[model samples]
Target: MTRRVSAIYFLPLVLAAGFLCFFLDQKINASAAPAGFENIPGRILGSAGEAVGDTLFLKADAYFHGGETFPNRPPETKEELGREGFVEDERENEKTLPAQPAGDWISRVNHEVRRHGHYHLTKDKQKEMLPFFAAAVKLDPRNVPAILTAAFWLDKSFDRSDAAIEILKQGARDNPEAWEIDAALADIYFYRKKDYARGEFHYADALRKAKSGDLTRFRRIDLTYHLAESLNFEGKRALALEAYREAFSLYDVENQTPLKETIRGKIQSLVVGE
Candidate 1:
């Protein structure tokens, strides 16, 4: 009779244990699902998101630098995709792009790639940096400082002028009013493209806006002089003389001209027969 009673009590206790185990297991699974299920996919998505986010932020910050929100993406790519296939350009584009927090996405991308690339460059690790720098420049073309920095460290960096030109062209499109962009374009045309007329046009375009009354006051020295040089090279002695004269006049205003006398001397040699 005693043995039978022990068995009855022990059976209930065993059943209770099993129930407790089941309850605990269910709770653990519920808690683990969030982190466990999303562990790998979340990381991948996060990385892709960060890459895209940073690129958008950089471009936004570059153009709308007043701490304004980033602009929406351009429509050219949308149209291109539409032409490629049956992908329609609608509000549904957001379906593919993840939502973003507020900020300059392009600038953020520049900072990210620059940070990673700079570190690698310092360690003399070109293999580690070239691909990253290429991607950075490709995505954040307006970030010329980043490109310049990486180019300074890379071997035969001048070879990347094509890359710089591509970015600058985009910058020109986005920031048409910026004289510096015009000047940069001129530099590329003159120095890299060997197209003096186009290059001269860029410098002249910059000069139209360069109200700075001094050579030192101008944004860059090379642009100021090169345009003059191009004039002389293009057989426009009259215009070249005028440019040098204006350059000197600008220097006279600030007492900080860039070798005005040399430029004046050049004018004499060209105009009056040295």
Candidate 2:
């Protein structure tokens, strides 16, 4: 009888332990399940956003080029056309061929109804292209090409250097590791804004990042040369000479004769100036 009572006590303890373990396991799984499921929706939305961004970029590119065609040739200068034996009439044809404006279905229908069989010149195509690039960046903030191209047009075509600088600053924040952003910043500061100090700062940073990344030797040489120029413009003759010498060292003496000569000229000029 005593042994039977002991057995009954041990059975209740075993049942309680098993129930506790089951409850803890359910709690653990309940906590983890929500986290896993939450990521699924986020991943889906991110992919959809990237796809929409791509579509907007394509539309913007079509507008920028004024058509949908492979290998869009840039508008030729008069000198280039003359060299190519193109007469004035042929040179006129070198301008962007007019095309229907790219837009949503409703917009396309409206355009067709309002101006059927009539072509309009895309003289303000760059301005019209800005909205799409802006929307693309809103959808996908990581769109580097859209950011860079928009900045280029703003600064070069629109004479909006401040706006371009702002956009590039945002891009640099979003993509800290992108050496191209720093390079663009350097160019704008050096050439457009005439802030040689800021230009030197960015160029040095860009060169460091490029060396750490996969930038080609030729490109690195270009960056170093520009860095030297920025330093020279800032009147830091000693540092400029050192940077120029570094640029010269980057050239392959036998194979890159012209490049070596160019860098050597820069180094010698700086040395003579000092």
Candidate 3:
């Protein structure tokens, strides 16, 4: 009877020990898993959200450029039209239509169309497009393009600079390493809000991030130029002159002669003024 009692006492302890070991093993296994494995689901959702945003953007663009119609189509041959019994007047009308611009014709046409307001989104369309952008950012806080596009439409189309700033601030928080976010925030602060000091800070931050990251040379030059402009506007001429000279030096003269010259002029102006 004493032996039976001792066996009963040990059963609970045995069960407890087994449970502890199982928990430890699970914990170790989880810790051993690849770091990126934990992030796979988030990345997938982010990509899906980006795709949705891109699709919505394309739809909006198509509606803006005349709904349901392909923007480019090869001209119908005269013989083909003649076979279809085209009247002389119709053929003459077709001939009078301007020839489509060659090479990247679609982009050129879209630009001209928007320039002349031949095809543009209405306020309702703009409003319709905003929700998808918001959804995209919600799914992927680090989606820089979605964030920037959303901010742009909010500020430019809806006249909601405050809303744009709020979204951009959220994006900046979510993507601390994104120089584009800082650059965009700088632009809004400088031009829309006329908060030059804040603009200078963000612009400088953007340049720092850009230099530290793998940003292209052309993009760095643009950022530096804007930074100089912000400094100049804030009456920091000495700093602006330094920035402009740096921007000028960054340019590939063979490919960017005009841009380099423009920066040179700014630097000269600053020097002459001094």
- Number of the top candidate by lDDT? 2
Error of 1 at 238 (Å): 1.2
Candidate number with greatest TM-score = 2
lDDT digits (tens) for residues 40-147 of candidate 3:
433445447556655655554445433422333223455544543222223222123234444697867774674221233455665766666666665566668878
Better of 1 and 3 by TM-score: 3
Per lDDT, what order, best first? 2, 3, 1
Q: Give model 2's TM-score versus the native structure.
A: 0.63
Give the runs in model 3 whose Cα sits over 4 Å from its true position. 1-120, 211-213, 255-258
TM values, all candidates: 0.46, 0.63, 0.58
Tens-place lDDT per residue, model 2, 1-274, is 3545587788999999999999986776675322234244323455587678777887787665444322334344556445433223333244362355576898678656642221222445458888887767656556788778888878887899998898788778767877888899899998899999999999998987765456888888888988998998888999999998998887776755676787788888877887
lDDT of each candidate versus the true structure: 0.55, 0.72, 0.71
Query: After aligning candidate 3 to the native by TM-score, how far in Å is the CA of 49 from where it should be?
Result: 7.7
Which whole-number lDDT from 0 to 100 does residue 44 have in model 2? 41
Worst 10 residues of 3 by lDDT: 86-95
Cα deviation of 220, candidate 1, in Å: 5.7
True-vs-predicted CA distance for residue 132, candidate 3, Å: 1.5
